[model samples]
Target: MIRLAGLAVAPWLLWPLLGAFIGLMPAPAGADDTASSPATLLPAPVAPVPPLLDRQQVDAAIGRLDGIVDAAMAKTAIPGVAVAVVYKDEILYAKGFGLREVGQPEPVDMDTVFLLASVSKPITSTILARLVGDKLFDWDDPVRGHDPSFALSDPYVTENATFADLLSHRSGLNTGAGDLLEDLGFDRETILSRLDQQPLDPFRSTYHYSNYGYTAGAVAAAKAAGEPFEDIAERVLFEPLGMSRSSYRHTDYLGHANRARIHVRVGDPAERRWEARYDRMPDAQAPAGGASGSISDLARYLRLQLRDGSFEGEPIVDAGALATTHLPHIAGRLPADPTERAGFYGLGWNVGYDDLGRVTLGHSGAFVLGTSTAILLLPGEELGIAAITNGEPIGVPEAIGSTFMDIAQHGEQTVDWLSFIGGFFAHEFAVDPAGPDYAEPPASAEPPRADDAYAGTYDNSYYGPLVVETEGGALSMKLGPADAPKRFPLTPYDGDVFTFEPIGENAAPLSAAQFRTGDDGGIASVTLEFYDRTGLGTFTRN
Candidate 1:
């Protein structure tokens, strides 16, 4: 994997398959995510295709969603997009937007590759279903017993927790910087040792979303299915559905020129400073979220799911398995996680329902670098809609499905359920949190000097070797060699406290920093706090 900060390229290439996809590395068709590499960051824009009459009407229902996504894309400076839409068994929409690269001037087509991120989970689940169909393994089988290499710090948990427990996020694990570990190509044996670091109470009442849980599940699936997870996904889903372009291969496998340029927006507008493109992640984390493919492939995959895992008039996964996969294993209000609170879990999917209890099975995926998807199925309505966008959609799946279902089932408007849940949280946290937390939080007690004090090297457990620097009288954080945190002015609160309004708000949702003292009453490290369930960590100067 290549690492270039600020999304800019060095003299090195971005690898081969990506370059092939970008087609050209020239301006307007530049490859890479942030903007740097052997290729230019400012690729030429392809011809714009205005939304047509049909598109306009479709946008009307999904407009709030469309607005949220387009704003995020513009804010991020990502150049192109391709999406597939499926309603029940019908392919309602298959379209591409913008271009794969800026300079190549070729619009993104049906086969442009992208990093799938957590979307890989459903594919993993599909593979396990096939194994269940064969009686090769049961979902309730304790995962550790299947793969003896799977051990936790707590042997009891490892010895007892079943695949269903881990698959559904009941394993109570954390990210554990799992992607970074896997990116370095850590073997299964080495990585399993970290399992003890994340503990779970047998009947923990609260829900915790764990990506690491899925990684372990992926590993277990490979062992129990008697094949690699990639082979099972292709054989059971991709090949059967004719999703030819889909691959578990990393986006980095593509040559530099063939990859779509990724953009990081300075502000929430395209007119602002747009950073160049780069993809700095390791290829080994593909199981968590690294597959790439075109819209057609996604549509075909959706078609297979809509037909109850049947393709070409034959059942690839038995109907019984499919039902259990969609069954609600656990039910509660959306978990109390601070940042990623879209909905709750049903096996590998998110289960969202209303008071009268109509169920929609779905899921969403996103990563800081790029790529995302939102898909929901209404069994009673016999309708399924899958919407995959490149970045944050702020709950666009409900908007898309609501609009489509209105027109599909004879023009009836239904409440946007996503809006309700999202808004409920907005009112709770963004609008009326328990109390006025940061409405004029204390100003920094220090004078407005250059980024002198904070501009130095620091370290953390999650991401190491963090370097902060001063530029234009504001402070910016360099996270490893990847993207630098946006610079912002820092101010003083009361006493010796300080406030970093712009950048600090984004840092972690804490108000300000306060110093604590040792037994001698001397200065010690300051703590950065956040809301419930989110982590609160401290950094001491070295």
Candidate 2:
């Protein structure tokens, strides 16, 4: 009975949100790792991404939010959103918006579950902190102390990497370095084995956001606790905190009936049209971003943070240990226009100051299957906000959080954030309606060779084998390790270039597949440009 309304609008945020903060940029055509003829490429103008928020509009949005959300949802056509606000040790608001599914009449309610994505990190950190309170392992203890097999390319880092370093994303690896393996169905152990082969960024010299680093920390925590990561999280975090409705496993989330379906806009920005897909992040990545829960459940989490590691007069974790998670372990800058005046990367939380110079802590997460989430905690103000949407790249979560903060700090004012967001995004989409048009090849060009010529097995060190085959004069691909094989149906665009649409229950956006010819006119290699604008290159013919 607590359904509200919200608009899922924002053209700039349309990029895939699976990785760390570094992979948010939009992709361009002819930007793949392989060499191709310029004449065969299709280039289009890239739209300028709007800044995070407009102060005036944010103030306005908070006032007329209901009507604004209704109008914005009407325009964007997004299916559903859920929001929760915790102020001064109490939940000030908790509600859902729109339907759980497009054709289903069951409206989303406060209990509707949605994937937390990377927002699961703070919880993970909190659990680890509890384990530390039990003297399982110290934060600065070397990772190898828990798991001797833990190794990295840099010998010093491999020997000295601590639990704190991994949680804070300062383990010296590049952003999302091993994500390719995990996405392709590789297990955590398998991906971790190949991690030493990746290049290191510099020993604590830079903050390179990494999902793998957090997973590594989780593995270490599990090793020290003598149990699985999910089990430890449940015992130390969920159960202790009384979050009965939350779970770290996707399988568990699926068993719940009130979960919100994931969705994304397919064609143009002007259209609010969306396509729903089930969450496909493997259980192996759960430690990094696989938890699911409802607004009511998240409110409990915010409450726990506000109380400094206590829930219902019981100490779930030592306040001192919990405070360590908020301490700035590494300083860094955010992607905002002004470069995030004062920002630091804490364990699983982004610690920074708002425009009002008040301390704020938060993190965000998303997946290719269509989910975006953000959680913010203002310990100084005893306020927190958690926003989850079944759609992506809309900036809805941040908008909601900032709107709530605006209300908390400056007192309530006349604002319609949703309508203002919708109108601004609608106009921006109208100005540059085409999305990723620059990433496609020319459609009129003929195939460089027969379909049979390109049919064969291609392989890479990290991504494994990709089998391209022709069936009934059409091309299709099956890739990844043997455990999880994904198939893609291909359509020829320009010469030797084909676009593949993910085929299966959990579908992804169309990706470009370009086959390169050798000097002898035989297919030499193929390069695939994925949704995140990163390319998997030189899948040499086998």
The Cα error of candidate 2 at residue 26, in Å, is: 29
- Give the TM-scores of the predictions, in the order they appear: 0.63, 0.78
Backbone clash total, candidate 1: 55
Candidate 1 per-residue lDDT, tens place, 1-542, comes to: 11222322111111101110011111111111332311111223333223222434443434343443354345334566555556446665665666665555766666666555556666667667777778776677778877887765467667776776666666656433244334333444444555564445443233455666666777787787788866777777777777776777654336534455443334543455434344534234445555655567777766666667676578887655654555444433442353222234545665443222334555555543434455555543334555554433233333344445444432334443344433432332243356336546445434433345455555444333445566565554443223343333334455435444322111233355444454665434444442112242354544
Report the lDDT tens digits of candidate 2 across residue range 1-542.
01114433221221111223632211111122221222112233133232343435333534544643455466556688787767667776788899888778988889998888888888888888888889898787889999987888899989888888898888888877677667667788888877887788877757888888888888988999999998988888888777887988888888889988888677754654777745565577677788898888899999998788888788888776777776656765544443224356667777654443344577777764677787767665566778787875455665556556555444563245544533443343242345444245665667557778889998777577889987666788888778668777778778887887644322345667878888898998888766223343558888
Candidate 1 Cα errors over 4 Å, as ranges? 1-79, 101-104, 174-192, 201-204, 251-261, 268-285, 332-344, 352-359, 392-398, 410-542
All models: lDDT?
0.49, 0.69
Q: Candidate 2: which pairs clash?
A: 13-393, 60-415, 60-416, 61-415, 61-416, 61-417, 76-272
lDDT of 1 at 429: 27
What are the clash counts of all predictions, listed in order? 55, 7
Please report the candidate that would top lDDT against the real structure: 2
